[model samples]
Target: MLVAGSASPAEAGTGQLLVHLRSLLPGLAGALRQVANVILEDPAWASRATIVELAERSGTSPATVTRFCRTLGVAGYTELRVGIATEIGRADQAGWEVGIGADVLPTDPIDRVLRTLLAVDVQAMHETAAALDLSAVDAVADAVVAARRVDFYAAGGSAAVLEDQQLRMYRIGIATWTWADVHNGLTSAALLGPGDVAIALSHSGRTTETVEMLAEARRHGATTVAITNFSTSPIADVADHLLGTSVRETAFRAGAMSARHSQFLVLDLLYLAVAQRTHERSTEAFARTADAVAAHRTPYEPRARGGSARSADPQRGA
Candidate 1:
């Protein structure tokens, strides 16, 4: 069976909790999926209803409900209620600031707009991180480390993320290539075989080009990994491994805005994991690249009056 998201489980926060739960759907089966669907379809019910009532609504037995709660790492039904209620109270206290489903509006104040955009993107990153299957991440890391070459395919906003990954992996001295165009992606994928890795990024998991490229890579015997929002989409069908991100779209905050942020979270994790596998080499490569680039750039200096200057070298971030 495919492993689902969530490192352990989560106050912990039912709104966020529900997001985590939905990510686990790909790994659930039978009545478990039913119970999860019920709670997800109506979180107010999860926060307020009785266990027996939830069971009835889910069309499952009380035993199954209890099992489901346990699977989520809650002690039992009561704890689930407390957790959901805590999240509800937290949401109420946050007022409109949580911004889980709110959209940016032209009429809104600048602070409100900033808060909404930041809140949604921040929540997406946190939730995406929490829902990641570390074991899947590890497997991808292993494949990356062992592969002779890695090719990445992504279109639109996802291509920006792929470019970042390409740069990062290359900095660490790993052989990497990326293509944002369908023809180029397919051409690169055709050259991949047994020891190669092909990673495709698509928020909708239905991108025709990415799906076809991944399929072609698999046909050529490459290990395929898909980073996407939907676990069961056509892209996932062709991928040997699925890395999922949960990003809900608002009117103004579409896939390009928040979904790209979520995908970056996954890519950062994957990149770091690959780096960790080759710690000494990765460290040396980064230092070498930094030194090489530093020679070409002007030294950091405070701006003089009415003059501009570049920022300082990246110190360890706080």
Candidate 2:
């Protein structure tokens, strides 16, 4: 979710949104963890709620809510609410009722590449299934629901994944901070307060900077969540919550491409699970936000061709 990266106009918003959806850490603050928790408890509710209402429910100031909204990359609460509504619609109609299977066999060179894609993803997901800790995931989601602020620290390839988490959290109404800088991470952890949470990501779970930041957040009395591949890593061992991804590594694994994608999938699942539980508060926030948008919208010129008057054809959106 790097602001400078290629994101559609519809996808762009406050700086934090870029990181929220695309990556994880780029020097995020501690205030956003609480917002993440609220959204996680109920995505539909968060998507429908307003910033003022979100603040009231979370018991924070309006300014903090505004900052949280902007950080997640929406124009404001209204745009986020609308997007969340659509997401909820999609969720309610999810294809979970049907048998889900994706199997690809080799046909050509293109087919071979496709199989490679399938093979890698399938292997990783299977590993993820075996490696995941349900209690830890539920705890992380619950912590996101209850926290007053949220901070994410990711280094190496995981930083990009952290940003993606930020985006999904924002859509569901979470305020998250991401840190890519070791120095800035210390600054963030040093500043964390009560009702806040910290998450750290590392495939090896051995990054000195990431662990250092987690330690700092702990010192500041913040809840800690660790997402990593190794269960015995220092961060994971000390974390209150631990979520994992298992990505099979091979000699061809350069640029950390396959592993990063798996990381993203894991992050998405976590963000959505949290959203599923906190639908009520999120809904109230969205309603307030939608009303504000309706009140503030301004008229714009119609899109017409050849300098002629546009036709009043609502059927085709004239």
Candidate 3:
């Protein structure tokens, strides 16, 4: 299994504890899931509750609770407690109000909805940054910069994210292509070779088409990267590098909607890294691309101070 930043439970900071729990929920089941639900439902209570109290609350034995802590990569119940408490304290210090995770009600004020959405999205980015492995990111960036070409595969909402990356890469003169169609993705994957790179995007890391495309690319000798929310997800298994995001679903924003900001955070990091690695080339490409589109923009006139506006010569400058 992939460890967050390769940190052992003891070394893992308390800030990411809640984020990890949320990401791991989909993969958990049975008594383990029960323990997780109880803690998640009221983590402030869990922080102060005794091991026995937690077990009783979850309707599980102490032994099961121990197993749950182990699954979270913590040493024991005490460590888990400290982590939860510290995370809560940090959130409080940040002035995050309680009920930020509440579902958006139809009757809620627009400002309330705005606050809730911004809060969750910002939190997701923070969690993703905290848990992301810099080594993995650098490795993927190097691979992307050196690759002969790159292929991106995604379906549904993830496709929009891939398209954004593809455009950015293209602007920097990278040979990049994105596919939302499974057949086209597979075809591109089949043509990939040792110098090629393939990236698949999936929120749950369980999208069959995305997984298959990455698997196919890997089989064809391409370096495969998976950006997903869960490390244990199937897509992670096939990837040469895994970048996980942390996103919690509210009733109004589920799956890709909740995951978009987190996913964009990861992609933006990778893109910037690649651009930095090829700074001179990237700079020229960016300038060239900008100039190519300059004529398409509407011309503007600058107003003189307390006087008439001066028109810009569209052919010369705008």
- Deviation in angstroms for 178 in model 1? 0.3
Q: TM-score for every candidate vs. truth?
A: 0.74, 0.55, 0.92
Top-lDDT structure, candidate number: 3
lDDT of 2 by residue, 1-318 (tens): 222212322543221122132223222346565665566456657766778788777767668767766665566677666655654454345432211122233444776656666655665564455335566677778888888778999887778789778766765577887898999988988999767999888876678888989888988889888776555556665576767665544445632555676677678778778878888766766576677778678767575666433464445444
Cα lDDT of all candidates, in order?
0.79, 0.64, 0.86
Model 1: per-residue Cα lDDT over 82-105, one tens digit each: 766765565566554663356777
lDDT value, candidate 2, whole model: 0.64
Candidate 3 residues 192-244, lDDT tens each? Answer: 99989999999988999999999999999999999988877788789988888
Q: Once model 1 is optimally superposed onto the true structure by TM-score, how far is the C-alpha of residue 129 displaced, in angstroms?
A: 1.4
**Could you list the CA RMSD of all candidates, in the order they appear?**
7.1, 21.7, 3.4
Off by over 4 Å in 1: 1-17, 20-42, 49-96, 301-318
Give the TM-score (vs. native) of candidate 1: 0.74
Backbone clashes in model 1: 0
- Top TM-score: which candidate number? 3
For candidate 2, the per-residue lDDT at 201 reads 86
